[model samples]
Target: MSPATQAMQREDTQNPAMLWIANGQQLWHTAPKDSNGKSCAACHSDAKESMRSKAAGFPRFSAPAGKVITLSQQINQCRSNAQQAAALPQESAELLALEAYVALQSRGLPVSPSRDPQTRQAAARGQKLFTTRIGQLNLSCAQCHDNNAGKRLAGALIPQGHANAYPIYRLEWQGVGSLQRRLRNCMSGVRAEVPPYGAPDLVDLEAYLAQRAQGMPMETPGVRP
Candidate 1:
């Protein structure tokens, strides 16, 4: 399901993820192992001032990788090079909490997908993937998310394949990161052969999702079921 569908409207004062956000705030300011001994705050102090608005613009292309990358991947990369901390495993609590923290920083900002011509082409490629069926079940993403949106599958409402809030703490996965992980789950559920992470198709698909979510608020590391 899309995060939009997963999101339960609530008073900002009663947000459940607020505690995790506080944890993230502390982690950002607290120094890590002394090997480098530099906190994320040491270099980038004040997330609200330095990182808040920036969180709205992500899942963007990276010149170094020559492909678009998600926010968590970027954060792990920074932790490795900047803080000398080992890369947090995917779905790990550290990663999830951090993702939630960063996402919460941009709670009200609008999502901005890439607009470069290259981005459009990438999104087009993703659209093709969304509509194509390449596995034993012969079902496409459109089968459930697009065509069957709002329908129930195993008691859960199928939602539009929106990528507005990612790196979410899903009740299923119980961790946080890009929607690609969820995509892989959907492919497996449909008896499809899942591609390796960071594959070309997934990159294209990410581009496509970013475009689809254009102008929607980015809520990362969100909680969902």
Candidate 2:
């Protein structure tokens, strides 16, 4: 990141993403006005304690759903099955804030996704997606992240593209964003057909990212350029 970007990330006062965090904290405790009215706090009580290290293992298998689900998906599931509240849109601001807030609870912890048999297969599929060239540019994730990391592309340096520093405050984006959002951005960059928010490929790809970055510390609500 450039010097200005680095400085913005260092403190909440300089970080715009903190605005979302404040809203997320409120959502965590405010009960929805619905039939199964309940806030996340109603069940978990306190986030910092109950949610500790949970985000680090996310994008994991959901036996009930028969596939891996993201932290946002799991949160939505709770709203439906447990609280009977209307679900938030996949990439809505409210959802992002809530997701960021929850993810922040697991900050600094290592990502430790499950290594179940099904997950292994999914991870392999994700690897295929990462390596396979797509889009008009015909680029794969590996070409930039694996092959050309630490090099500049269109005036920006390409990092390893790991998912660890997610729910991040990107200077270019000017807001908090999740790993899935970043993937979509990459897809668009390649001129590839961007997948829908909860598409199977996206889910599988997220699982693979978490696995690839296994043991990397979570940098929830991280800042980036």
Candidate 3:
């Protein structure tokens, strides 16, 4: 990123994502319309205390869901099971805002996905997908993000493809977006079939990425160009 962009991200006042964060903070305390008069705050109280380091362990196995799930999925589960509310639509502004708020609580914490057997298996599948060639370009994720990182592609730098900074403000999108959205963008770039949001394969890929980025500090609500 350029120096100006970096400065914008570092300062909360200058960060556009902070708007979503602020909305999320409000949502945390306000009960959903379909809820039984319960908000996230009703159970967890202060997020600063309840949600610390929580984002590090996501894309993990969920006993209730019987599969590996992303932080967004878990949030929806909580809404359904605990609040008796409908799930938020994937990529919705409200959902993204909530995710950004939750992730902010874990900023600077290390990535620490669960070590359960199910999670491990999902990560393995993700690794295979990462290496497998696909689409019209017949390119794998490793080709650009691993084999040719720092090289120019379409006049932009090809980053190393870490998943630490997510729900980020992308200049390209002019808004904050999830890791899954970014994954879909890559799939499209390769002219591959883009999976629907919340697909198991995407969740598996996230599991692998969290493991790959283990020990790295989270930079939630990050800014990128």
In model 2, residue pairs whose N, Cα or C atoms come closer than 3 Å (at least 3 residues apart or on different chains), thus clashing, are none
How high a TM-score does candidate 2 get?
Answer: 0.95
lDDT of 3 by residue, 155-203 (tens): 9989889998789999989999999999999999999999999998798
TM-score of each: 0.83, 0.95, 0.98
The TM-score leader among the candidates is 3
Candidate 1 on 1-225: residue-level lDDT in tens? 454534532333443555566778888887666438888889888888878766666667666556666677777777887888888776566766677787777877898776656667788999899899867889998888888999898888787878777666565654444577888888888888889766778778877887777788766546667
- Compared to the true structure, candidate 1 yields what TM-score? 0.83
Candidates sorted by TM-score, descending order? 3, 2, 1
Q: Which ten residues in a row have the lowest lDDT in candidate 1?
A: 5-14
The TM-score of candidate 3 is 0.98
lDDT of each: 0.73, 0.87, 0.93
Give lDDT tens digits, candidate 2, residues 1-225.
Answer: 778877777777987888998999999999777737688999998999999998888787888778888899998888887788988898889899999998889878999987777777778899999999999999999999999999998888989888987789887887788888889999998899999898989888988898999999887778998
Cα error, candidate 2, residue 200 (Å): 0.7
How do the candidates rank by lDDT, highest first? 3, 2, 1
Query: Which candidate tops lDDT?
Result: 3
